[model samples]
Target: MKLTILGCYSATPRILTNPTSQVLEMRGNMFLIDCGEGTQVQLRKHKIKFSRIKHIFISHLHGDHFFGLVGLVSTFRLLGREADLHIYGPKGIKEIITLQMKLADSWTNYNLIFHELTSNDSELIYEDDKVEVYTIPLEHRVYTNGFLFKEKEGNRKLDINAVEEANIDVAYYRKLTQGFDVVNENGETIKNEDVTKDAVKPKSYAFCSDTMYKEDIVPLIENVDVLYHESTFLETQSHLAPKTKHSTAKEAASIAKKANAGTLLLGHYSTRYKDVNCFKEEAKEVFQAVELTQDGKVFEF
Candidate 1:
């Protein structure tokens, strides 16, 4: 899995960073996590194919998180893309988007599907043969949900030498890769363990932003391979953090520690602090594997 941070500044844009947007690439597809302002331009600058982004997951209705959505959709229309697009967001998002489309008298020439989320509990919103997406309810100023993207386990590796030694037929290759026993032409059984190994462990990523300290969501993203959590403030400004329904670096690390995440990538830094090392130091107090996200930096897992 690959994560490209398009914007990382909090509250407002900075000379160095934009707002809050991230592109997650997996399974030969791009899944946009947030569409902050200038997202389309970031997509272009990063050389990511816009048409490959069929699924979009919005964390909340906050302007910093979704302001670039309409522009992106319009750009797709202008580009003459006809593929179906799936958007998963809060309940009011579809209405806002459709209203924009109605007022402009411009409609996308493709299938647009909206999955509105209203529940406060964790729920599966998308699933396919290769990946699954779930909502992680978060404590924020408004209704908010973090998204968990998980890639399914791959098929078992085939032992070609073992298969050849066993005189395995080509017709049984598929079954062997699926960890299924193969029946020989002579009515003999070839157990899957004899010619195949366990499947590769699946990878998972979790995105949490614009939320306060919430521990209930830990289980939903427990043991995630990578966790991107909002760290809008350092420990010294922790009081201001929760007062604004945001989290400090220490709080973000606590969640990562409880969830046992492999690595914690912190972003959404407030402009008050010129340096970001304070955040890294504070979070490291609880979680050892901590990293700061810079705009345009790509993290691979």
Candidate 2:
């Protein structure tokens, strides 16, 4: 799995920084995490094909998180895209997009599907053979949710030497890989464990933004391979975190430590601080595997 940060700054876009937007590439799927303003431009700058993004997940109705959605949809129409686009977000997202289209007298040529979420509970939103996406209910000024992307367990590997010794037919190899015992032509029972090896463990990634330092999320994101959490303030300004429903760098790191995440990626930084290195420095005091996100940085796992 790979994640490309299209934008990472908080609140607004500037000449060198952008708001919250990211592209997660996994299991042959490209998922747009947020549509903050200037997301399309950042996508283009990073050479990520807009057409490859089939699903979009919006954390909340906050403009910094979803203001560029309408423009992106319109761009797809202008590009003559025929493929369907799926958007999962907070409730009323469909109404918001439809209203924009109605006001502009412009509708998308492609199919636009919306999965509006109103429940505060963590629920599975998307699932396929390779991956699953779940909503991570969050505490914010407005209704918000983070997303957890987890890879499914893969098929077991067949032990060719053991299969040959057991005289297992090629036709039964598929069953062996599936961890199923098979009966041979000789009426012998071939055990799956004797001819198969365990598959590699799957990895998971979590995305949390525009939320406060809520420890309840630790269980949901426990042991994630990578965690992208918003750190909108420095430790010195921690007093503002709860008031603004955002987390400071140290608070985000604490959550990461509690969750036992492999890597803690801090982003959605406040623009007041010109040096983003300070955020990383503050987070490292609590979590060793801390990394600061830039507008176009990529992380592969």
Candidate 3:
């Protein structure tokens, strides 16, 4: 799994920074996490094909989180994209997009599917053969949710030498890879473990942004391989975190520690501070495996 941060700044765009937007590449899927303003430009700058992004997950209706969605949809139409686009976001997201299209008298040529979420409980919103995406209900000024991406267990690998030594036919290799015992022509039961090794360990990524310091989310994101949490403030300015419904760098690190995440990625920084190194320094005090995110930075796991 890999994550490319197209934008990471909070609230508004700056000369050198952008708002919330990222592209998560995993299991042959490119998921756009947010559509903050200038997202398309950032995608272009990063040389990511717009059509490759089939699904977009919006955390909330906040302008900094989803302001560029309509423009991206329209761009797809102009590019003559035929593939369907799926968007998962808070309730009323469809209405908001449709209204924009209606006002502009321009509709997308490609299919636009919206999965609006309203339930407060964490729920599975998307799934495929290789991956699953779940909503992480968040506490923010509005109805918001982060996303949890988990890779499914792949098929076990077959030990060709072992299979051949056991006189196993190629036809039964498929069954063996599926972890099934097979009956040979000699009526002998060949155990799956005898022919195949274990499958690769699955990896998971949790995205938590535009939310306050909510400890309840720790259980949902426990043991995640990579966690991206928003740290809109520093501990010195922690007083503003709860008031603004955001989290401090220390708070984000605390969540990472509580969840036992393998690595913590901090982003969505407030523009008030010019130096982002402090965020990483403070977070590392609590969670050693913490990294600060920058626009256009890429992380692979």
The prediction achieving the highest lDDT against the true structure is 3
- Candidate 1 per-residue lDDT, tens place, 83-196, comes to 999999999999999999999999999988999999999999988898989999999998999999999988999888888888888998998887799887677899999988
How many Å off is the CA of 162 in candidate 1?
A: 2.0
Could you give me the TM-score of model 2 versus the true structure?
A: 0.94
Least accurate stretch of 10 residues (summed lDDT) in model 2? Answer: 177-186
lDDT of each: 0.91, 0.93, 0.95
TM-score of 3: 0.97
Tens-digit lDDT track of model 3 for 1-301: 9899999999988789999999999989999999999999999999999989999999999999999999999999999999999999988999999998999999988899999999899999999999999999999999999999999999999998989988887888888989999987787999888889999899999999999999999999999999999999999999999999999999999999999999999999999998999999999999999998999999999
TM-score of predicted model 1?
0.97
Point out the higher-scoring one by lDDT: 1 or 2.
Answer: 2
Clash counts for the predictions, in order: 0, 0, 0
Cα RMSD for candidates in order: 1.2, 1.7, 1.3
User: Each model's TM-score, in the order given?
Assistant: 0.97, 0.94, 0.97
lDDT value, residue 66 of candidate 1: 94
Model 2, 172-261: lDDT tens digits are: 898888889998768899889988999878889999998999999999999999999999999799899999999999999999999999
